[model samples]
Target: MFYSSSWSKCLICLIFITSGNAECPKPQVEGNFVLTNDALLKNDFPEGTEATFECANGYLKEQGSERITCTSGEWSTLELTCKKKDCGAPRKIAHLTYEFGEEGTLFGASAKAICDKGYQLMGSSYRQCYANGWSGRPRCEVVTCEKPIEIKNGTITEQPDKEFPEYGGVIQYSCDEGYTLIGNKSIECNEDGEYNSVPPECKDGNDIPLKPTTTISTTSITTTTTSTVPPIIRDVDDIPLKPTTTISTTSITTTTTSTVPPIIRVSGRNNGIGEHDTNAATGNAAVVGSVIGTVIVTLIVLFTLYRFYKRKGSYQTGEDPSRKEELLQFKNN
Candidate 1:
């Protein structure tokens, strides 16, 4: 009985040692990490057991082993570490700029795009980072304006052959001869595909009329007369007869004439003088004729006075009736 009891104690001691050596301490896993391909969920694991590690959901393994093993009643050091997954920088877009959210470019992070001036954004404005990469890239496009319509009697100064105009482009206008511009001379294309100002038009210059021409003329005449006594003739018969009276006349004349051209005045209608324009020339000629008649009368009076003075001696002898009658007739003629 003593030997059997000693053997039973030894057996109990051996079993305790074997059980202690078979189990290993629990492995420590970082937060957000899990053991992959492990079937045993108990706190302790058997020696020589192995397991791999992996990060959950949005996390990725970083700078650590992906596997662990149990040995000598203890677990191998848990070197597995996990970090948040990153999608890197956002994709580049033309004419577009991006802003990041608090999560930055990491997994599930959000970013938004803003288009520059004179540009429009296409597709969604916001994008999110995923395991694959950033979501579908948003794009920016330049704004355009429609082609400008042609103006009447005018032409566009620049880029006339282009089918469409870009934002902020300018269009200038000009009018042809005999036409006037009636509105703004230039217009600019806007972001909404429309012009900033209305188009200009050309108006006819002949809408207003001209006035008729008028002419005027004036004439003035002045005449001056003087009387002079002629030399007397006496008869020899001692009878004092009344000296044959002789009369001499001198005349002077002055004439003034003026001619005026037709003056044109602008009014509501167009008018002109046709036949009436000759009247001014006719009046000027009449003034010249009157001046010539006065000069002839003055010359005739001077010649008659000189003849009477020379014949005075012959008339002093005897007066013959027939001769006197003949002399009177000749002087009258």
Candidate 2:
């Protein structure tokens, strides 16, 4: 029993010596480490030690080496990664939207902003997408076409004021009689969201001419008469039964009748029972008619005589009885 006890004591001593000799020394912890971002450097750790990494709030570790066992008092070559706050690329816009500020940004990216129609985006238009949630609170602003409100003589030619991204455009208008325009006559789009000038005025009016004018009147009179005159004699047998002579004469007279208006002046007598008064209207008409008739009668008589002489051969051949028969028939017809 005493011997067994001594052996046990010896074994205990041997165990303690072996344990002391085999123990791994505390890792040297020599390699420099970066606490910032938990990013590991090229020489971050040594082969014989262990290492741990951590990231700041709003940050995360991309690669972790929280604990590494030491081999030969050195850690295996390793790396730790701390990710900077990652703002995801701007989200896919739900509706078609324009960018007024920087785009394609990172977690801390910021930019001026605006909404589509009707509403506007407020807050420091510029904002960041962060791990701490979207940076600036975005509020919807009301869009309006206020001030100088009415277009005056003109109407809105295009869409009125509306919420839009920075640099969004606008249009205005005016109207006038007898005139028109096709395209937008005036337009403005600025970073400030206000129009630059008012719409233009249309051209003025012009006059045209009228139709023509004139006046006048006229009158005429006609009369007919009958007369007796002989045809030319072609033969002796054509002897006439009566004188082939016409007598005509004319006279003038003025008369005033009670029926005549006082506005017209009248003169002479209207009595019809006396010898033609040199001043009687009837006597005058008769005298003139007689004169004309006498002239015509004289011409007829002369013509007949010449024809008679020609048929009778009174000048050159003395006379021809058969020819006279022919002349007589001619005169009768």
Candidate 3:
């Protein structure tokens, strides 16, 4: 019984000493960190024990080992350190601006992108910081409009370049000579790829009056004067029943008269009437008078020849011998 009691006491003392020596010193970190794969959250560790350290959110490990060990009742020397994650300054984007959502450019931080006036964004408007770098890189581009349609009888006078017009660009319009404009003289490109107003059109000028035509005609006439025969008087009883007229012995003379009338013609631009001149009337009268005189002389000669022939025939028959002889003697004389 005494031997068993001594052996039990020795075993108890040895177990107590072993338990005291096995306990490890607590480890101190320079910055915010946590043990890797540790579920208990214990501050101490046993001899020959190992652990890995991880930095807190928004922090990164710097110039240190992430692994440590406990040995001989003490913790091994740890050079572990942590610092705030640093994403460099934001990159410059043409025609774009940015705003930070947080004070530092650390993990989980973000920035918002904004396009300048007359500009547009080609990518995401928000950027986020990560362990490697920024989450996205956005770009800015100038807003543009479609090509303007051509105008009839007009031209664009103030276009500066051949490319598509940008937002807020201006185009000036003008009409050709002798044409009138029907709309605005200038138009501006808008964000919707169109102009603010419709383009102008050209119209023809006002009509002019035409001149009238007229025609006129003129005619001329000439005239001449002439003398005419005078009428003679004779006693009524002086002439017997013959067609011939007897003349008195006081320087007897024959006179002829014309009955022909003058011919007149009418002619003008409007078919107007015209009168005969005095010369034409006189010429017609002269011609008619000459013909009348010839007829009178012929009739007188015929009557004389008829009387002579009858007397000669009577004498040849000897019916009135004394009278026929007297007529023959007179004819001979």
TM-score: the better of candidates 1 and 2: 1
Task: Please give, for residues 227-317, the per-residue lDDT of candidate 3 as tens digits.
Answer: 2222233235321121333432212234443443344443332334455544546656566666666567656655765675465442122
Query: How many clashing pairs does model 1 include?
Result: 0
What is the alpha-carbon lDDT for the whole of candidate 2?
0.47
lDDT of 1 by residue, 34-135 (tens): 776463466557788776778877788787887777787767876777788999887677789989989989999989989988788899999888877888
- Worst ten in a row by lDDT for model 1: 267-276
Per-model TM-score, in order, reads 0.49, 0.29, 0.47
Q: Give me the candidate number with maximum lDDT.
A: 1
Q: What is the lDDT for 319 in model 1?
A: 67
How well is each residue in 149-259 modelled by candidate 2, as lDDT tens digits? 334345655654554423445665665434343344676644345655555544322211212221111212122233334444443543433334554332322222222
Model 2 spans with C-alpha error above 4 angstroms: 1-15, 18-67, 70-88, 94-148, 151-189, 199-333
Model 3 Cα RMSD, 1 decimal: 30.8
Q: For each of the candidates, give the backbone clash count.
A: 0, 27, 0
Error of 3 at 137 (Å): 1.7
Model 3 stretches with alpha carbons more than 4 Å out: 1-14, 23-32, 36-44, 48-52, 61-83, 102-104, 157-163, 207-333
